[model samples]
Every structure is written in structure tokens, then in C-alpha cells.
Target: MKRSTPQEAPEVQVETSGQLPPHAAGYARDKVRAVLGQAPEPVLFARVRLARTANPAVERPVTAQANVDVNGRPARAHVAGHTATEAVDLLQDRLTEQLARLAQHWEARRGRMPVPGSHEWRHGSEPTHRPDYYSRPVEERQIVRHKSFSLVRESPDEAVFELESMDYAFHLFTDADSGEDSVLYRSGPTGYRLAQVHSRPHPAGNVAVPLTVSELPAPRMTVAEAQQRLEATGFPFVFFADAGTGRGNVLYHRYDGHYGLITPAE
Candidate 1:
């Protein structure tokens, strides 16, 4: 596992039109007042903008956020909501309650609770229902098929685009020369990881490779890092890992060894 010092998120610049929305602007005002231990008087509200997850077709509810300029500095929040109205209400209520409480909390603990932001969680144990669209008729199914096929021996990048185009969470491919096997998979917060097969892959192919390829544990990184690392490694001849999410983050289960760090690959 590669460890690097953590860096905080960059500040957001809030644009303005010499006005603020009633709900959006008030929410910001409330947050500042919360910390000041008084009603909003000197504070000036700049702007309120509505932002949401890019994809709307997915069944999962989208999250909304707000960026407000309090006094002359910037204060922001990324609260949860499925709709604009719901998001506005959430911001209103949260700002109203917390701003006043901020001063109290800070005084008591010498800090304000870390403002909430987007987060994702992973699950444990095996899935009871292994749903399959591969078998389901295409007319009724979203996924047409997960046809098992062979790929020309090459780097993992060639295979990654294949998965992205097909919208696959993972892929099994042939390695150059050594005829070794590996899997490119995505699970949980860890977008994707490379697994070089050091051992046998799942035999049935009826489900996700039941077998772990590498003994190394999963890595803590983003999809981009995973691909970069695999490219750097020159496709070592070994069994690949199965990437998935857990309580911590996306992890990779090695073919034989304990799942280790799957950190961002430079």
C-alpha cells in the first residue's frame, strides 16, 4: 500500500448577480448566524446555485449541494436530496439548526463538526440473489449479454475501454505471452482495480470469479489510478484480483494472499 498525506478539497468560487434566492440565500445566512451566536444582521448573502449528480436515469436518488458566500469568505455544504425542493428544504433546515450550533460545538469541542459531503459505503458477506441479465431476454433486460470471449494478448488499457463501452463492472482477459489470466473489476467506492491471476480463476464462469487471483488485498484508489498502475507494472504474469467494496473502501482480493492496499496508482 502506498501512503500519501491527505489534502483538503479546494475552495469553490461562488458567482453572483447582485442578488440571492430566498431559500438558497437564507440557508447561507443561517449557517453564519449559527456560528456567530446571533441572528443574521451584518452577514450578506451572495448566491445560491443548484447542483446534482450528472446521471439522472439511474434508479438511485441524486444528491444536491449548495455554495454560499458568507460575510466575505466562502462557506459551502453538500447535503443529500432527491429533488430540488427537497434539497432546498434540507439546506434550509440544516443551516438553520447548525449555524447557531456551530459556535456552541466549536466552543465545547474547539471545532465544528466536519461539514457533511458525499460518501459511499461497501457491503460484506456474499450476495444471496445473483441477478443475471445475461440470461434474461434482451427485449426486457437492460444488459443484453455478458458473452464470455477471449481477447488478443495486450495491456489492460485495451481491455478497460472494452468494459467501459459495454458498461461492465469487470472483465477477464488473456495476458501477453505467459498466457496468464487477470480481471479488471469495479466495486464500491474503489472505481476499479487490476488483478493479475497468480492462481486459478473462478472455474464455473457462471458467476464472478469465485477464486481470488492474487494474494494481495484490495487497493484504496480511484479508477484512474488503478489503470495507471497496471500500465506501469508491464502486466506481470500472475493471477488477477477481484475488486469490490467493503466497510472501508473498494478492495481487491488477491488470488491467494490477504487483500492488501489498492491505493491510488500515482
Candidate 2:
């Protein structure tokens, strides 16, 4: 009888949009493979997208984004640069950092001590450069993206870990303790703040990390009303409870200046 060999996992597929260099896709594939190849957990699915804006006024027209499912947990990174190669380089760096942090998180969750010098958590090192917002006037901006899904239910600590590892400015989830729709975001360089549909004071000992609950509850309004407030206030984003469904919703400004909305699925 002949011995059979195990099949190797398929290579991650890279996708490109807008006008990119002919070699952009291949270059991105090589970079992604190099990073995901060394992931601590098995990569079940991975996708890379590279897009370029045709507008000349944008300083960083090239944008690169990557999403990877590592052992059932998802990790994501998004970055922008002046060129395709530069963007891919930044993407690789960001992905590597996120994965390292995620590995440390998993180790802690499993009651294992993280390897010394394996990773570092620095709030000051978070990426500051973001793609320029669209030059279009705010009044002309429209809601270009709307995402609806069942919000995850997790502890505040778990939500903070996901927010950092996924490079999200804000994370929306259901509070496991209070059973309320909540949004978690960075408060300052070192602390985090939580806003919920029905705001309530939380005991300081409830969360291990430095977290504060918002005194003001999430505003109740329709999508249209939220849009108007966003335009009037020029806030980076708005978190509210949908008046009709009473579910948590986030209306934020995209890098392109267009509005993007995230809401819980009914």
C-alpha cells in the first residue's frame, strides 16, 4: 500500500480595484503569504484588497486592507500610502503587529504565560495617519455603506481586545453583564469609554481595565435624523439607538468622507 500525503492549504487570494499597477496584485500576494505563513494559529480564510483613488488631490491614494480568520477568530488591518508598494508594506507591518497582539491575547485566555519580549502593547504607537476624507462638501455626502449584523456579546475586556486587534476606532457589541447594546471606544491614550442605549453607572470593579461608562445615554433618532446631526456636528461618528427598532447604531464618516452605518440586525 502506498502512503498518502496531506494536501497543503490554498494560497490566499488577492484582489485589486481601481487603477493599480500590473504587479500590484502579485506583490500583495507575496507579502500576505509571508505574513500569514507565520501566524501562530491556523489561517482558515484570508483576503487582501488593494485600491487606488483616481483623484489627484488625495495625498495617500493607495489603500490596502486585509482580513484573516485565525483559528475561528477574525483579524483585520487597513492602511494607506502614497504608492502601491508602500501601501502593501504598511499593510504587512500592521497585520504582523495585530497578529502578535492577538496571539498574546489567546495565550492569556488559555491560562498560559505569554512569552517575554514576544509582543509589546503601546497605546502611543497606534497608527495616526489616515486616508484623507473626500473633498466633497459634507452636505453632499451620502451614506455609501450600511452594515447590519448580530452584535457580539462579550465582556468589556474582550471587546477592547477585539477593537485593538482589528484596528477599529470603535467597536459595537452587546454588554454581557448589563444586556444592553453598547459601543466601546478609546477614551484617551490609555483608557476606554463605553456608551450604551440606556446609560447606567457601572461599578469600577466590574471591568479589569480602565473603563468608564457614559453618563449620557445613546440618543434615540431615525437614520435621517442621525445623518443630519452628523453633518451639523462634524463628529467623526455618531452612536445612537434606532428609534424604530431600538437597536444600537453607529453612523460614522468614512475615509472618503461618505457616511458608513453599522446597526444590529433585526
Best by lDDT: 2
Model 1, which residues run further than 4 Å from truth?
A: 1-46, 52-56, 60-63, 69-74, 105-266
Model 1 — which ten-residue stretch has the worst lDDT? Answer: 125-134
Pairs of colliding residues, candidate 2: none
Task: Name the regions of candidate 2 deviating beyond 4 angstroms.
Answer: 1-10, 114-121, 127-129, 203-206
- lDDT for each of the candidates? 0.36, 0.82
Superposed Cα deviation of residue 123, candidate 2 (Å): 3.7
Backbone clash tally (model 1) = 27
What's every prediction's RMSD, in angstroms? 17.4, 4.7
Model 2 over residues 1-266: C-alpha lDDT tens digits? 22222223348788898999999999998898888876767788989999999999988999999998887889999988999999999899899888887777667666676432312444454645345677688677889999999999898877888887888989999988788899998877677889999986773235656777899989999999999998889877899999999989999999887889999988
